[model samples]
Target: MRKWLPLIAVCAGSFLFLLDTTVVTVALPRIGADLSASVGQLQWVPDVYTLVLTVLMLAAGSLADRWGPRRTFLAGLVVFGLASLACGFSPDIGMLIAARGVQAIGGAALAVTGFALLVAHYDGRERGTAISVFFAVNGLGAAVGPLAGGVLTEYFGWSAIFFVNVPLVVLTAVFTVFALGRDTPARRGRFDLAGAAWFALGAASLVHGLTLGGEGRWTSPVTVGALVVSVVAFAAFGFVERRPEPLLDLRLFRDGGFTTLVACAAASTLTFAALVYVSLWLQTGRALGPVAAGLELAPLAVASFLTSTLAGRVLHRFPPRVLLGAGVLLGAAGCLLQLGLAVPAGLAVTGIGVGIAGPATGAAIVAAAPPGRAGMAAGILTTTRQFGQTLGVAVLGIAYQAGGLAPVYVVAAGCGGVTGLLALVPRKQARVTT
Candidate 1:
């Protein structure tokens, strides 16, 4: 009974975080029209949540390190629930966007520490299984969000997107409060305020630049300044992470498998973000509408969730390189198919192939990481993934802002193919798994 209880709360929070991110994609235009938002304000709907969460993730990781994961996780649940309620009741887009920033703080607190909580209690193969299950459940929430958001927005209203989070947040909070017992570590440290500060500001500046590109001319000073700051700040972050008491452990990347894991993580995120646009193209470009577009792209998420879980189970037996190579091949094939996806059949086939790539990537990353470093490694993976998605979204925006879906597919296919080739590069000692 005790063993099963933690899984329930963690999975619940995972679902809520992912669900909100994916679901909001469908509500963007409606949100703009209702709130009378400019393109920048509209972009903030997604940008604020991602920006704030990305910034605070390292701090959350440090908190888990200092006090313990259980106390932090429960605290996150309470705050996240309140933020959801704030988002639902927001009177305008500005208020909703601000609420999203708070929601992200809570999400970062949960995500950076959630898997660590499980790993602390479990060991070896069981830990692998738990990671697999957590990814699977979270993947489901992400996969389902767009379709659900479309239906709710169409029949209910745009605000229904936030409202939908209410029940899920409540349930997660209740579970965390009742089921999770306390746990703490003797180890402790001061918060790496400087490192976290750099991450938040740098990421926000970068994303703001990218998001602004969708609304205005690329030559705008606002865009250029944001981009410049982003670049400089990120470089500083890299330097800071290498400092003696870095906010994030820079040394973790030195492990042989770590770089490969980061690549896989970034690629997976790029794929998910691609789906968001490709689905939009199916509806907006081809005039199909939200549900039709969602149905068309559903195969990818479904396949990804299933494959990631299954791959987790077998990862311990296979060499990590084999999985990475296969994933690269499949991802390349998926990209090629996407390049050909001018028709619905082409879209469906490409989407399903991409879906299968998700778990293969997840399996390789989790297998490559050391046990105690899982939380830190996971943070890096997610950060890289988010960065990749940010780039993918920006690239798609630049190519087809007038809303041509075919060109977007062509770009995604090209980017994905290049990343896949990089993944296939030979390693010095490639047999990473025993």
Candidate 2:
């Protein structure tokens, strides 16, 4: 039991961090009604959080390695707690959105460091077990976030959803401190602040352009300018990362296994974007309430949780590439299933695929990282996931508007099928040494 305490603390904190990613969806209507926010503002509430979280993920991992995971994790808890408080009390949409951005900053820190800490503490079979549990809990949080948000919003108002994080974060912090103890300093390293800035700017600009374009601003100068900025900033980022002591080590991408796993991460999370459309189908197309919609989505979470455990146990016997290919194919089947009469089953099936794929891919990426770079590898994996979600929201969102929800599912199915086939391509064994 004592030996398991650190995993508990790490997973708990990670759960809180990831939960906020989707929890806000069910409360958007309430927030708009109370705050009188515009459609764009409502979208920003979630998009900004995602944007900040993705932008800072690599930087957060660097900080964790430089300062030690324990300190970085604790600081993130404090920032997230304080930001949640601000979010809960904000009187207007702008304030709430701003607070959410702050929350994402802390969330990125906790997310990268929390997983890195787990990798640090466990190895071999034990490491696989810990990662599977982490993925399961994280998936569970994301799956139930909407339901939890709806229940809290229904009973205690939307503010309650944000406030709920406060206590949970506080408890996690306490447990984390007790279990992880003080941070011991590692060798100090140079932080490429300029490269980080360029990356953040590039990512934000791209997301902003895509979002605006999706929202009927395609012809707007603001949208065009954002696109241009994204291109230029990304070019600059590429140049900057080539320098020594760059914020993100570019050499990490040379490993084919890590690169494939990153692609797998993006592919798996693309389905996550489909979840929003599913909720919309339930609420708008089917006329279900938020709570009911969320409840209907529960099967996805339950299936994922069970399958994650199954994956953990079976991973030892199978090479990661095989497990990864199977998981992706399962997800493809799930997406294709949604096109027919088996909608709920499709969602659950996709959850099962995600359960197997995510942990397997993550473990491969972590194993492929160079010595002392596990945090960076974890950051890259999550960054790809966030990138996929952002793309899904922007691109699929447009498809939903133009062709309705059916076409959106078709696109998702196609993406899953292609990625699954790609995962089957033979690759050298993943590098697992420090």
| Candidate 2 lDDT tens digits, 1-434 | 78778999999998898888888877777788899998678878878887888899988887787888899999999999999999999999999999999999899998888888888888888888999999998888787788887788878999988898998998998898789857654437688799889999999999999988878889999999999999999999989988865666666667675567677788787677777777767777888777887887787788887888777787778878777877877887888888785878988998999899988987887867767776777778778888777777777777777787787888887787777777778887555333
| Regions of model 2 farther than 4 Å from truth | 185-187, 429-434
lDDT at position 385, candidate 1: 58
Q: Write candidate 1's Cα lDDT for 36-142 as tens digits.
A: 88756765676677667677776776667676777888777778878988987888888999999898778877886776676666667767677667777766777
Clashes of 1: 1
Which residues of candidate 1, in runs, are more than 4 Å off?
A: 214-216, 255-257, 342-374, 428-434
Best by TM-score: 2
| RMSD versus native structure for model 1 | 3.3
**When superposed on Cα atoms, how far off is each prediction in RMSD?**
3.3, 1.8
